[model samples]
Target chain A: MGITGLFLISFLMVHCFLNSLIFINDGGETFNLGAEFMAKNWVIRAMEIVLFGGLLWHIIQAAVLTRENKKARPVAYAASNPSANSKWYSRSMGLLGTILLIFLIIHLRHFWVVSRFTDEITSGKETLFNEMKEVFSQLWVVILYCLAMVSLGYHLLHGFKSAFQTLGWNHVKYNSMIEKIGVIISIVLPVLFAAMPIAIYMGLIK
Target chain B: MSGNMNLTLKVWRQKNKNAEGKLVNYQVKDISPDMSFLEMIDVLNEQLIVKGDEPIAFDHDCREGICGMCSLYINGRPHGPKDRITTCQLHMRSFEDGQTITIEPWRAASFPIVKDLVVDRSAFDRIIASGGYVSVNTGNAQDANSLPIGKEDADLSFAAAACIGCGACVAACKNASAMLFVSAKVSQLALLPQGQPERYLRVHNMVAKMDEEGFGNCTNTGACEAECPKGISLSNIARLNRDFFVAGIASDN
Candidate 1:
């Protein structure tokens, strides 16, 4: 889970970067070029497979852990004050992950499945970008994308440091620095991913 | 005011391991503010005994907070509503004159009930047994300063060694992960040369045992450090993780 989580973190960075190209706003020329390279490259095609497998494994790992945790305490505490102990998101990983899971399904259906399963999203140089513009034009899709990115941000906030901790990559001095970096990455990465839909929907990059 | 108060207590009561438990309310009138939390409970137990009812059962040994046997979730905080102090260290004066103090056992999937307010924490024992020790020593061999340990290492080891095997970390956790407690033990031994022989294997065995015991994975909530009466640091957990990671690759025979 730790390895795969870190893998996903890198995947998100690459993904957000590709999506950010849409900001170039040259009628999707640059974004389409990058998207075409990703689609055509054999190395990336193989990695895409590994990425999905890793994601599945990650989700399953969380579910199993959650189940064991829930089972460990057969009976609930009479009264709980979880908020006092940790942040609400720290306690709500399953919720945040579930939200991201929903967003992933919608996200893939809009682009990935369309790109691969049909030429609908890849029939031209600007097909994928056109799809993004079409998708984000809907206020509800834009809202859902923003909400999902927020969830992703919160998930990574705990998960980034947690992955390193799980892998045992820590030093007394370095761990604090790593955690500080983790916080910035968690916040910045999601905000960057979220900006794509919001930017397009607001016509900032038309 | 004479620093005395009358308060109602809602204490958790369970008949046995399999039976259902609930909060039983009791009135302890005119309680002195000077009494320790356990002393206050002792007074209530005395009343219950005199009234010919089964007295409330709780775990306690050294009432000075070193034993770590006193486990209570008072008013939703582990070891009561105080910072860095065990329930044994908490006093009645911390509460208001007419306040209602709700007390419950440390509930977790890992620990189960022996009776009311006394869960069997032998799971912790099993984890320690799996590997919280160095196998190299039962006899005296080395001189006191022969090893030339660093001051920082000694202090860090002592800090980790301070954990009292209390399940408060588990109780306070949202996932009931024992990473903090496990890390404390793993860190203490791993810091020393005597512990070097089994360093990798020790962390590997302890962590595997922790998982096998049905404890949840850590989400790094930092609750364990917050509720630890000994003020156990969370950094030990990271060290444990580091060792565990190393062990996975390096411990191969």
Candidate 2:
């Protein structure tokens, strides 16, 4: 689970960096070229497949673990003062993860499915570049993307370190440093992704 | 009359785990401001017994902050409003005259009430039982200088070791994750050279025990740190993760 989780985090960093290209003066052509490059590359395609697989595995494992945890305690107390002993986000990962999953579906529908099926502006298979710009042009779509990115940020903040801790890489000497890294990665990547849509919606890069 | 004050106390009363509990109010006259919180509770219990009412049940040992056995949810705060002190150490002077103090036990799913205000925290014991100790052979005590541990590592281990197995982390957690408690125990031993032999199994067994105890996973909200009487750091949770990761990989291999 830790390996898969860390790999997913790395994927997010790369994906966010790629999306942030919208903040630069891409003039439509840069995005189109990048999109074409991804479409044509076998390695990227293989990675995309692996990314999807990892997402499925992670979600399934989380669900199983949550179920097991719930079953371990058959009786629920009338009052729970969990905040007395644990972190809030660690307790709420399932909720945040469910929301993130919903956001993921919406994300794929807006970009992945749309690019593959629609040809309102360009021919079908025109490239993800045009689809991204079209989606960002809509104010509501941009808003939803930003919201999802924020949720992702919160999820990652708890999850990044949690994955590490679960794998037992936590040494006191490097523990604080790892936690700081988790914070930076969770915040920076999502903000970078969110910035792309915000920049485009405001016509900052156009 | 200056030091003496009458106070109203609303204390949680439940006959047993199966019995429903309510906050029953009692008026205590002539409470000294200098009396410790537990002493005040003792005074109230004495009054209750004399009146033929069942005394309120609560947990306390050593009456010091070090034991971590005193678990009380006082007026919307764990261990009362005082920061960095256990319920046993909180003085009655923290409250004003005529103030109504509400007291309840640490409520969480993993901690079931054995009686009123005293939940069976043996769940913590089980997690510790899983892997809280080093596998050192019983013999002559090793020389302190035998292990060449760096000062920095030793200091960090001691800080993590300072955690007294208080369920305060579970009580403070919204999800009741025992990551902080378990991590502190795991990291303290894992950082030392003497603890090397059992390091891998320690984290794995302890985390497994933590899960078995039905404690929730760590969510990284840092509430445990804030509420910790010993101020155990959240970094211990991270250390636990690293150890678990390596253990998982090693086991897989």
Candidate 3:
């Protein structure tokens, strides 16, 4: 889980940086070039397979772990005060992941499916940049993107440090630093990702 | 008398392991504020005995917090609402005059219910038996200064050893994972030179045994640390994971 999770984390950084080209605000010309490079570059094209594999591996591992965990306690506590001990998001990883899965499907339908299957972008009939403006132009899509980022933020907040702890990389001296960095990554990545849709919807990134 | 509590108790009553258990209500009046929670239960049991009813059967010994034998999930929190004390150490003064206290045994599949308020925690014993010890030649005691140890390592080992093998970590965990308990046992030994001979073997075997015993996987929820009566740190768990991974690669068998 930790290995795959770290892989996915790194993927998000790349994805975030690549997508941030929209902030160039040049009517998607720069963003389209970046997207074109991502599509035509053989290295990235190959990595897309590994990225999907990592995501599937993570989801499957979570499902199995959650199942075994549920089986450990057949009889639920009649009353439990879990809030006294752990954070709500820490305990709700499965739920947050489910939400992300739904969000991913919607996101893929909006862009990945269009670009890969429909040939709209490859045929020069449409550019990936215009696709973003068209997609984020809707209020509902922007709101949905924002909500998904919130979920991603909370998920990463617990996941980042949790992966380190699982890998046994903890130290008295470095633990606080890891935790602090986790908080920063959780906040910054989601905020940056969310800002894109909001920026586009508000006509700031045309 | 003015400060004494008259509280309602909803105690779980089960005849035996296979019998169905239910929360049966009983009233105990004029309980002294100084009485421990178990002592309060003793009062209630005494009342049941006078009335020719079956007294509540619960496991307890050494009434101090060290025994780890007193396993009660009181009012949702393990060992009651207190932060770092067992049920035996929990005084009745923590409650109000009319507060209704609900008590139940630890709920986990691996730890079966032996009777009311008593679950079989022998699973933990089995996990310990697997590899919680170091192999030493049966000979004269070694010189005390022969194996010089650093203070930080010694303190960390002592802190890890403070785990009383209470099942609160399992009960408090939403997943019923025994990671904290097993990790504490593993950490205590891994930090010392005395435990160096079988360090990799101990971790490898113990973790395998723990998985065989059907404890859940840890999700790093931090509930175990929060509810642990002995304040066992989660760092021990991190150590366990680290050692286990190393053992998987390094251990020959």
Candidate 4:
């Protein structure tokens, strides 16, 4: 679960970096070229396959683990409060992940699957960049993406450092530093990724 | 530092795990805020013993908060109202006069009740026995610099190792999961050079044992962090998932 989640985070960084080019004022041509390259590239397609597989594996594993956890404690205590021991995000990973998964489905349906199999939306569009902008033009789509990215950020905050610890990279001196890094990666990447679509739709960047 | 106060204590008293338990109310007067919560409890127990009562029995040792032996659910919070301090170190000053405090044991199936407020946390020991240590047998001690570990890795390992193995994570968990504890132990050793040899086997075995012990899976509530005396991070559980996944794949290969 950690490996898959971390891999997804790495993908987010790259995706965000690529998307950031949209803001470079090259008249959408550069963004269109990048999109076209990604669309045609075998390596990118292979990576997407891995990313999808990782997402599926991470979700499935979390579901199974959650089911097992419920079975482990069949009875609820009369007075039970969990805030005394753990972080809110640590305990809510499954819920947040589920939300993110729903967002992923919506995302793929509109962008990925739409771009690949359907020609209805792209009939009059000259470039993939135009289709991308059209998709983001809808306020609802942008809002949904923003919400999902926020959830993703929350999941990553807990997940980033967790992946390191599981691989046994925990050391007292470096643990705090690694945790801070995790926070930055989780928070910064997702926000940056979400910003591009909003910025493009809002005309902050042409 | 010395101020007298009146307080109402509602403590759970049970003869054994099988025996029924309920909150028994007792009024404590003249409590000094300077006294630790446990010391106040000691005063109450002394009064009970003098009155020929059995007195409240709770598990406590090394009141310094490192042993993870002191477990309490005070007024709906684990280890009392203090943040990042164990129940032993919690002082009375945190509470106001005429306040009502509730005390209970660490509630979990794995930790069966040996007596009032004292559950047999031997299940934790069993989990550790399953694979919490390194199999490397370096006779005596090796030089610290022998293994040129990065400062970052070393620091992370130490942080993971800070887990005191208290069942607070389990109790604080809505699902009663022990992932934080198990992961911290697994990650602390797994990250170190000495722990590499048995990393796969260790995680696989320990996680399997944790499952067998009836500990819940992590639901990611972050309550454990709020209640933890050591403030062990939930990221450790995430690390556990990664290691387990790797181990699962490796074993399959």
* Best of the candidates, DockQ: 3
Docking class of 4: acceptable
Candidate 2, residue B154: lDDT: 98
lDDT against the true structure, each candidate: 0.88, 0.79, 0.93, 0.81
Lowest summed lDDT over 10 consecutive residues: which window, candidate 3 chain A? A75-84
Model number with the top TM-score = 3
Per-model TM values vs. the true structure: 0.95, 0.83, 0.98, 0.74
Task: Determine the iRMS, in angstroms, of model 1.
Answer: 1.4
Per-residue lDDT of A1-206 in model 4, one digit per residue for the tens? 65777787788788888777887867777877787789779999898888888878987888888787777665456565555455678778888888988998888887777777887434635566666788899999899899998898888888887677655565567888988999888878888878877887898776
lDDT of each residue in A84-104, candidate 2, tens digit only: 544666667788889889988
Model 1 error, position B43 (Å): 1.6
Runs in model 3 with CA error above 4 Å? Answer: B138-142
Assess the local accuracy of residue B143 in candidate 1 as a C-alpha lDDT between 0 and 100.
60
Model 1 C-alpha lDDT per residue in residues B1-253, reported as the tens digit of each score: 5778889999999999899888999999889998999999999999999999999999999999898899999988899888888899999989999899999999887888899999889999999999998787535546646778899999999999999988999999877889999999999989887888888888898989998888877878788888898988888987888888778777783
Q: Model 2, residue A204: what's the lDDT?
A: 77
Measured against the true two-chain complex, the DockQ scores of the candidates, in the order shown, are 0.62, 0.31, 0.89, 0.29
Q: lDDT per residue, candidate 2, B10-107, as tens digits?
A: 77788888887787888998899889899998998998899998888889889978888888888767788777888888988998889888777777
